[model samples]
Each structure stands twice: as C-alpha cells, then as structure tokens.
Target: MMDNKTLEKKAIAAECFVEVPFFDLDPMNIVWHGNYVKYFEQARCELLRKIDYDYPQMKESGYYWPIIDMRLKYIKPANFGEKLLCIATFKECENRLKINYLIQSAESGEKLCKGYTVQVAVTTSDFEMQLVSPDILKQRLTDYISGLS
Candidate 1:
C-alpha cells in the first residue's frame, strides 16, 4: 500500500469551492461523510474535462472506463455554509488511471478528507478489457503537458 505523500506525487489537481447545504449535514450539524464522495466525483470530472477527455468522450471514443476501486478517509468535519475546496489529482496513468483527492477548508485550509479512485478502460462495443488506455488519452495528456511548457 502507498502512503499519502507518495500518492500526492502522482496527481493533477482541480480545486473546487463547495457550499455545504443543510441536507449535507448530519445530526451533529457536520457534513455527512457520504457527501464527500459527491464532491470528489465533481472534481474528478472537472479534472477530466480539463484534459478534454471525460466519461462521455470516452464512450464516444468506443471505450468505457469504470471505477473499479475507491477509498475515502475523513479527517475533519465541515458544517453547513462552510466553503471547502476539493483537489482532485491524477495519481497514475499507466495500465489504469488512478486519482487522489484532498478536501480542505477554504478559510482555514484544514484538511477535511482524503481519498483515491482507480479506473480501468474497457471496449464499449465488445466489452473487452484494455491493457492500455487508448491513444487519445495519451495524446491529450501529452498536449496538455506541452501547453504548460
């Protein structure tokens, strides 16, 4: 198993500011743990969009990538109306795409939660598993990285 520091090394982040809602709170007036998963999903999708290669595009490309593994760890509690920023980073792009996540208080920068997800590519038409991701994904990453240079 990899440690948090090690996982952070393989990520690309998309920061999101979320306003906690009344329904997101538990009986304790803190954000419910399950709600964090939604935030993670939101940021993950945004990060994929940054690369112009998200779920819809993946399917259009004749592939289907599913979340095969996921994990979350809650460190602190956030209350209703609290603004929090979520960072979704890419952890791995080889074999499968792994993403690491971090949620922190927008005001105090206190870490609220951390997690990771793993997704594997599969053929959409025949449903055959792909040992390597499609070339479009690799090309997009390459172009995105080059644009930064």
Candidate 2:
C-alpha cells in the first residue's frame, strides 16, 4: 500500500478520478485488464490539457502525437464501483513524449496498477515522424512547469 501523496502531481502532472463502472469489469468481477489503458488515457488527457495541448490542439498544430509504446504492471485487482485515482506525470519531450501513470484505490490508498506510454510526433500533412519533438511541446512544458511554481 502506498500513501495518496505517493502519486501526487509534480511540475507537469495531472490526476483523474474515475469510478469503476459495471461495463469496465470482467467475468471475474475485477477491472478488465485492457481497461487500464483507457484509465491511463484519461489521466494523459488531463495532463495534456494542463499544458494546453489536447488532441485538437495537436491537429491544429499540424502534428499527430501517436502512442508508440506502452507498458503496464498490475499490482492488485480493482473491483466494480470502487473509486480510483489515476495519476499521470509527463516525463520527456525531446525525442518523444513520455508519460507515466499510476492507478490506486481512492479509499484504501493502495496501488492497483502502474504504467507508461510513449508518443512521437508525426507531421499531419505527410505523416512523416519528427526525429525531435516540435518546439511547441517543449515550450508548453516549460510554461506549465514554470507556472506550477
């Protein structure tokens, strides 16, 4: 078990609260393993929103940041109707966008799952991947990180 603050926000982070719905459960009465990715996406959206760079903004900026890889480690099972706290922390933006996630029981403060996703920027027009992330990402991260303090 970990404290609630263990996954607390940092300079570039966001937290999302989600309730385990009946549709998200499996026959075994626990959260479906695949649904954890959705949970991470929710937190990731919040994190990107904090930096004023949601999907729409990405499209408008002429780039598409696609998730290239993901990894998850399930620590415990989450039951339906349980309150969950999902945390996302932005980790990198130079070559790719990397965000780490943590999902825990809101009531018991126990870790349920942890993972990370990596995204690389690709030009929307030609679908060419950028070797380095566009300057906008770094600038937005810098602005958000500075504003946090």
Candidate 3:
C-alpha cells in the first residue's frame, strides 16, 4: 500500500472546483457514484500540469503512460448545486506515477471521496513497457520548479 506521506513528496498538489449539476444526480437527487471518477481524473490532470508532465507532453516525449491500476472510495453523497473541491497529489513515480485524490465539499471542507491511479510508461514507437520512467519526466519536473523558484 502507498503511504500518504510518501505520496506527498512527489505530489504536485492541486485543487479544482466542480458543481453538481442536476443531470448528474440520481433518483435521490444525490450525485451518482460513477461521477466521482471523472472528478478525480480532472484534478489528477491538473496536478500533472503543475509538473509540466501532462498527457500531451508525455506523448511528445516518445512514451505513452497508461493507467494500469485505480481505486476509489466514497464517504458521503453530494446533492445538486453542491460544489466540490477536488485535491490531487502524486503518491509515487520512481517506477510509475501513482496519484492519490480526494474530493471534498468546497464549503464545509468535508471529505466526500478518495481515490488513486497508477500509470506505467510505454514506448510510443513500439508500445514496449518500461520498467522505469523516462528521463523526460524528471527533467521536466526539475525545470518547472527551477523556473518558478
């Protein structure tokens, strides 16, 4: 199992806002469970962008990182018009990128859901799986922060 503290190290944390639309609600008027996955994904993407290593850039680097594992847990239900704050952070990325996510009510700061995704690197040229991440990711992350500091 991945530790929260370990994830925090490689994490590029980010927050995202999501409004629960009426259409997204089920018969009980609570946001459907399946929608939480989408929310998690949106926040995870944002975190990746902070490190300058999102999908598009990964593609350009001659590798395709595909999600190979994922898990989610919902603790509460959200109703229509409810605003959610999605938080995403990296858990590990030495051999693979494992991202952990949390969804909370924007107003109450109450956690509604939590999840994680793991992605492995694959060569785009021949679709060969890589045991370790390419140097591009490390270089991009280094340069991104150096430029900011």
- The positional error of residue 84 in candidate 3, measured at the CA in angstroms, is 0.4
Q: If the candidates were sorted by their TM-score against the true structure, best first, what order would they fall in?
A: 2, 1, 3
Candidate 3, which ten residues in sequence have the lowest lDDT sum? 1-10
Q: Please, what are the lDDT tens digits per residue for candidate 1 over residues 51-94?
A: 88889999999888889999999999999999999999877775
Highest lDDT: which candidate?
A: 2
Candidate 2's displacement at residue 147, Å, is 2.4
TM-score per prediction, in order, is 0.89, 0.91, 0.88
Give model 2's clash tally.
Answer: 0
Give me the runs in candidate 3 sitting further than 4 Å from their true place. 1-7
Residue 77 alpha-carbon offset, candidate 3, angstroms = 0.8
Name the best candidate (by TM-score): 2
Per-candidate local distance difference test: 0.83, 0.88, 0.84
| Cα RMSD of predicted structure 1 | 4.1
lDDT of 3 by residue, 47-122 (tens): 8888778899899889999899999998999989999999997777668878889999999999999999999999
Candidate 2 lDDT, 44-135, residue by residue in tens: 99999988999999999999999999999999999999999999997777788888899999999999999999999999999999998898
